[model samples]
Target: MSKYTTIAIFGLIAISAILYTYFFYFKIEERLPIYQPSQINPALVDPSLIAEKDHRISDFNLYNQLGDTVSLSDLEGKILIVDFFFTRCATICPILTSNLKLIHDRLPDGVHILSHSVTPVADSVSVLAAYAEKYHADPSKWWFLTGSKDEVYRLARTSYFACLDEGDGGYQDFIHTENVVLVDPSGRLRGFYDGTKEKEISQLYLDLATLKKELSKIN
Candidate 1:
């Protein structure tokens, strides 16, 4: 082969290598098989049997970072990632939220992030606003939310399947899991993820992409 032909062949091989790296190996973590109703330890997911029966939590009043009450109904048709966190947290919250931002930045305009403050008493609207600004959260696409402590706790347990305990609002004040719950446009619980786990976080983002593709089939 001539030198020119060899170079052209090399260029094609290089392009293929780049695509492979971006898609299969380095870009997103490999997704593990999530426990579906058909293949789960029935006891843990039993209550969730009503999962398909129960509609997504659609209507509720919560304060946005701006101190204004906002309703989930206001965001009905968006692909939402709901996560529970606190401003005062010295550990997982920051890391989890940072990873969440990674997920948020990758999504298209129609997708959104709904972050709920676990320590609602301490993380008032103003405080949440500060946190949002500190993280440079996009107000249009991301909402830092707060509401009644009891209601927040209830939502954490029933909605995200996260933990929320009662206390004096200090260390061990709130009990909640570290997972990003993905919800569909019609408000179905699609996937739950370990928000702070780097591998899982990446997989969750890609799963959102897959979820969107599945959603498109219905339309």
Candidate 2:
């Protein structure tokens, strides 16, 4: 072969290797969908907030299992995962907690998990403390929150859009859902998953990693 022809063939081979590495080993990242208030179930959002494009998790105050107060302010500028459960739950709650534990174990810095007690009356600070211990949860990363039943339920339905059940946080109000909600660093709802399912929880982990990569770009 001619010298020039050999050089051209070598150049094409080098370009092919670079493209393969860029597309496979160094995969291009993607951003998770930012869920708008109107896109969520109508029952969970107020008519006014529905049309608002920048709806976020509203401010809230609840004490963690360790008796430390946790609020929206605490989670500001952090990626957060939230789920609703009661300590006494006998069915899917355990599975949800287990899956959450896996996610927490694999989490990177600046990520937090909040498990709010749906039965705040029964799941007091002391009860939550024991539950946290049972799960071997890292208090710094995972928080089991408990507060007035009304406050917890209101935040679940209105702010988190975490449950399909409707309630005014009244005496008879109760919520039960298998969903685990994801909130971005900006406090916008980003994704939802079935906490009780292993496959869905796996997807949550991947989405969380994607979110972290997206945030890293700005920092």
Candidate 3:
């Protein structure tokens, strides 16, 4: 090949490689998968919603640690990190709360944590208040919620899909899951992680950053 032709070919190859790298990284980093009921495990999803494609979390009314009524509307423009936990559990719940506290301390103002009490009947507003205090939870950033067991369980099964076993949220029914769910500002399910696992927590952090960038584009 002629000298000029060889140099031109090499330059073109270098430019092509740069473009490929740039596009590939941004494509992967800029988008997170929007989860739906059909995409989640069947056990986690209510049977009626197993085939539904455009599912978003349903509206809920729950009391926070301070006895303030919090509804889904109140969190309309914020990214949510949600989990189900009870204060009296001897297994997994403490670790979940501690790890979540790490996230709470590091997350920006736009992100909020909602720890719903699965045993809300026993976990009154005062009980949740003490639990929040134990974790040094910021009332503004992290909310420990309690309300009707039926409503909370309905959210767990139909909305967030955070657990596997099914129940009616009755007196004998109970749910215990370590799943940590991520919701976008618009209430779409984005991701799920094992709350007790460090690797999963790290992945949650990375996904949160990516979601923040994705939201930036829209706003």
Candidate 4:
């Protein structure tokens, strides 16, 4: 082949390699899905929101373990790992809390945990505070929240889509599930995992790493 022709071929090959690397990196690093209400099980979603698109976690005002009021705005620009549990539980809650504690301890900056109390009435700030302490949960990185039962239930059903059962958030109603949800900084639901499963937690870590890469690109 002529020298100029050989040089042109090499240039094209180099360009092809660079393009392959760029696309491969981006393919693996693409952001997780922004889960919509329509994408979730209808039973777990409020009927009013079943057809809604672009759904985000609704605003909330709950007291944390430290008795500080925490709202959705307070968590803006944060990647949130969220779950629902009550202070007093004998079965899966303890296991879920333990796993979440592991996540909380290892979370990087701009990531936080929001553990909402299913039984907000029984899980007052004092109760949540003790629970938080039992787990050595850092107040800055992990927040055990308790507030109006109605609001918490609403968020569980409509926003996070964390459980399978239906409830009105009434005095007689109750919800219990092991689902852990991940929310991106833009307030979109990105993932759901079984909090009691080790395999699921491992997957969560992998997804979180991917999400961090996406966030890094945006920032």
The prediction achieving the highest lDDT against the true structure is 3
Name the better of 3 and 4 by TM-score: 3
- What is the clash tally of candidate 2? 0
Error of 1 at 71 (Å): 1.2
TM-score of 4: 0.88
Rank all candidate structures by their TM-score, best first, as comma-separated numbers: 3, 4, 2, 1
- CA lDDT of every candidate: 0.74, 0.89, 0.92, 0.89
lDDT assessment of candidate 2: 0.89
Q: Put down candidate 2 lDDT per residue, 74-150, tens digits, no spaces.
A: 87788999999999999989999999999988778899999999999899999999999998999889999999888
- Pairs that clash in candidate 4: none
lDDT by residue (40-105, candidate 3, tens digit) is 888787788887778888999999999999999998899999999999999999999999988988
Could you give me the TM-score of model 3 versus the true structure?
0.91
lDDT of 3 at 170: 91
Q: Which stretches of candidate 1 lie over 4 Å from their true place?
A: 1-55, 164-173
- State candidate 1's TM-score: 0.73
Q: All predictions: root-mean-square deviation over Cα?
A: 8.7, 3.6, 2.5, 3.2
Q: Which is superior by lDDT, 1 or 3?
A: 3
Candidate 1 overall lDDT versus native: 0.74
Counted clashes in each candidate structure: 2, 0, 0, 0
